[model samples]
Target chain A: MSTTVEMVRRPSSGAEQAPPSGALGRLRWAVVDGWVMTGRNMRHVIRSPEEIVLYFSLPIMFVLVFGYVFGSGMAVPGDGSYREFLLPGVFVMTMLYGLGATASQIAVDTGRGVVDRFRSLPMARSALLTGRAGADLLRALLELTVLVVCGLLVGWRWRNGVGDALAAVGLILLLRLAFTWLGILLGLLVPNPDTVSVIVFPFAFPLTALSNVFVAPELLPDWLGAIAAWNPLSATVAAARELFGNPGTGGESWAAQHALLLAVGWPVLLIAVLAPLAVRRYQRLSR
Target chain B: MTDETSAVVARGLRKTYGRTTALDGFDLTVPRGTVCGLLGPNGAGKTTALRVLTTLLRFDAGHARVAGHDVTRRPERVRAAIGLTGQYAAVDETLSGRQNLVLFGRLRHLPARMVRQRSDELLDQFGLTDVAGRSAATYSGGMRRRLDLAASLITTPEVLFLDEPTTGLDPRSRNGLWDAIRTLVTGGTTVLLTTQYLEEADQLADRISVVDAGRVVAEGTPAELKTRFGADRIELVVRHAGQLPAAAGLVERVTGGQVHVDRETRRLSAPVADRITALADLLRALQDASIAVEDVVLRRPTLDEAFLNITGHGASERTEVAA
Candidate 1:
């Protein structure tokens, strides 16, 4: 206890300087704060559970609308159950919708000056960003779990084994991690609360609905289908369809093989591209 | 700058947004352990300068050093040694008062145990122990300000920056904050405060620097600044508008300074020395002149007068300060 008191009397032992460059050091910090603040974020949700009820129900309503009302007309490229094929689309769709709420929370923080307070404090520079990303990833996981539970209630099932199902979950989370940075980037870009929905809604639909989340890309118009086929979300849904027992058949598209790679690649690439710029921008807000 | 103790030094800080310049070659020097007031009318670049010194905003040109460390080059070390409370109380509405302090303590890298102890100590010291467990959203404005100040002290920073810390506060709350600031200064913290209220600077600032349009218009102790631009003012209210002429002549004869007569109010005003004796003589002279006087008042120089003199009708205030 004396040692602890003595330690506080001296300078902070945290990253006063920049962190040492290595995978181990970076990942160590990423995981340490990743877990602590993730718990804290979850506790905030627990206390204000009503705040998320709207987010939880909205997408489930959309999935039901698409499955029962729109599924008969919509064509899938492969044969077999539409529920199996549609489930991956719904999973990917739910992940994309998570960005809207998360991004707006950041805008609220920005407006309330909480983001500025975080910047002024002498913490791990990356801790705030990493904690946010970690919590959003957790939110994505929870959202995925709920959508799956709802799917089960709706008589939806994946024919894959335990490992394959788990692999599909990993792939969906990987997709979420990539998109979370994109959400943070939007949050950083749009600093005002009133304009957040204006920014997130258009991007959410174009990125999610225009892709294979509900229908096969070939079913889209010639021009629209071309764009949808290359969207990274389309790749994720296609890859999930294959990994979760090929709800259609063991088919492959150019987007399927590379989309997951891009899904994994995008988050790292985004953190590389957007995180520093956003941190720098966040630092100089009133400047 | 003038052999001041120099706790903080800033030179040529500049920032521009589009076509307008917010700060232009601004320079400042603050002595250690003194409460320095950055007194300015609106749009005077006072907030810009404070933001740069606190390591929250970067300047396009020039430099600032806080507690002997360059803010630009060593922002982490600078941030470690400094605390800032903005004009608005930026308290998290979600957290309780104690939780707010503990959150800042943890962000400042205090251990869990120390965060707890220091948070309690601050709550007690700030007269907030009873309400510490309550959510800040439920707090009064004064309580939120106190908690915001408490959060800044979690690390016991050496240099504290307050930007209009008492704006919108009632008289009682303002004095309470003044007392807290004095206590901190006595404990060896250097404070740079910007305020629009002249009385606040008069009561609290060891020295006041009046900024106008991105420049320091005047910098000196309250006495020195007042003496440079002020004199003893004597006002006499005559019985009628016709008597203003008699009052003006009698005042001018004694003081030999210009007498300004308001015909509507039947009052005569002039600058002089030994204003009380002057008032006594003027009263006697008024009797001889048969000018029936109603009342008399001596107006001494206030920081308000000094502020008006230094920043007379500055248009930049439109952008710098808000009601």
Candidate 2:
């Protein structure tokens, strides 16, 4: 400690100076800085693979229990089997639950004072949020892969060709992206990770369970069915079913008929609303 | 680059959270390359003042400058020149010590090679080289704090803000931290420290500012503040327990200060002035009376007494402090 103090007291070389000068140069560094932050967050996930496994476990459990236990007497009123019909809903449910991960991560970061540390640096304002979003998107892709494999193991096959199947996976990820912004918004708004889980539970449980993911909205009471049909989760699930060429293809509702468009529209709309809200929440944090 | 010679300056900083006022018209100025101790109780606006200056928070009304840059208008410039180590460790627990340093170095835009070298240098300097590969979560409290301090120093910031940096450390760790802080100041890093521990302030600060009710109530050198607000104490421990009363009377007459006698310990204490003459007179009087004395000492008022005198209360007085 004393030697370092002496080293600092004397004039040192300017080796650790700022990277570059000018506005344009800073803008370039900002992009690179964001990538560095992304790598930092990704390293955490790598170090703790068990955490990722635990997060993935929930969706897998839901698939088996719902597929086997409920599949025995279940009917889809279409050519596709109930197991096939349940696959897309389970995927959507996984993505929906992923919103909590984003929220809790942000809450933990904020509570730990890492957010303040980042804010105090000369780095770009968007680096922290963008870095988190990047890691979460990668995580979402991993979960999607696991769920797809599990779906195959449980007799849920995608009859559609490569192009359509890829599109369905893309839609699921797009929904994840939308929910990621919502998570960021909630994370910034809440005080801690525990509170984030508490708040997210009420919304996630009802929204995922009532949507067309688990049961047809048409089977529910009239008002609830209308709500379920219009739910953003329902649109994504219906779209995934259509893309995978699964049976029970959203049965006769106008929402089912236009699944692909609504699936794309819901995420776009959510991003448009939640992304700015998240940014604003971040900016107004200590104000 | 700017005309301001002080490392930090804040004027009329006012911040409120609903009905509670965290900072109310607070003002401070810390000179360049000097340690400024912001001493106050738990609910005092010490942390709030730091947050505003570091650009981590926005005050409702204030004009603050750090490293000659306007904190609100030119925050990036201020941030570039300043580093803040908050009350919490503020480190990524999952990352190794070296990894945390590298992450901060990269964020500060240091060259990749420079970052690696700097991380190694800092880890060695802070005696963290052996554990640099381990996650910070595995570190002892002292080690985590050292790592946190290293993270803030990645770019050799012009001004460092340490808010209660040693709130929970043992005596050994606290001393280690104080040594590190002294080294930083010797190297010409201006520091603004806020701590509830009066000893920490006395050990670290060149100038001490007593903050209470969201503003500075008193500001001066530690010696000056102590002299102004504290009195010298004269203590006499008699060889015979029965001599306690006689010693107390002799000391009271010599010093003319309030005297407190503990008969069980046979100790007599009194606040005194003109320490040299008071001690001389008291000793001579006791000698003439043939009173046996085991110990005689004149002690200056402790920082705790000075703090309580200036703040009008102890640090434990948390009620209505935020208001």
Who wins the TM-score comparison? 2
For candidate 2, list the clashing residue pairs, or say none: A80-A247
Candidate 1 colliding pairs: B42-B317, B43-B320
- TM-score, per-candidate, Cα-based: 0.87, 0.88
Q: lDDT score of model 1?
A: 0.74
lDDT of 1 at A63: 65
The DockQ-derived docking category for candidate 2 is acceptable
Clashes of each: 2, 1
Scoring the B chain of model 2 against the true B chain gives a TM-score of: 0.90
- For model 1, how does the per-residue alpha-carbon lDDT over B95-135 read when each residue is reduced to its tens digit? 77887887777666566787888888778877789998887
TM-score of chain B of each: 0.89, 0.90
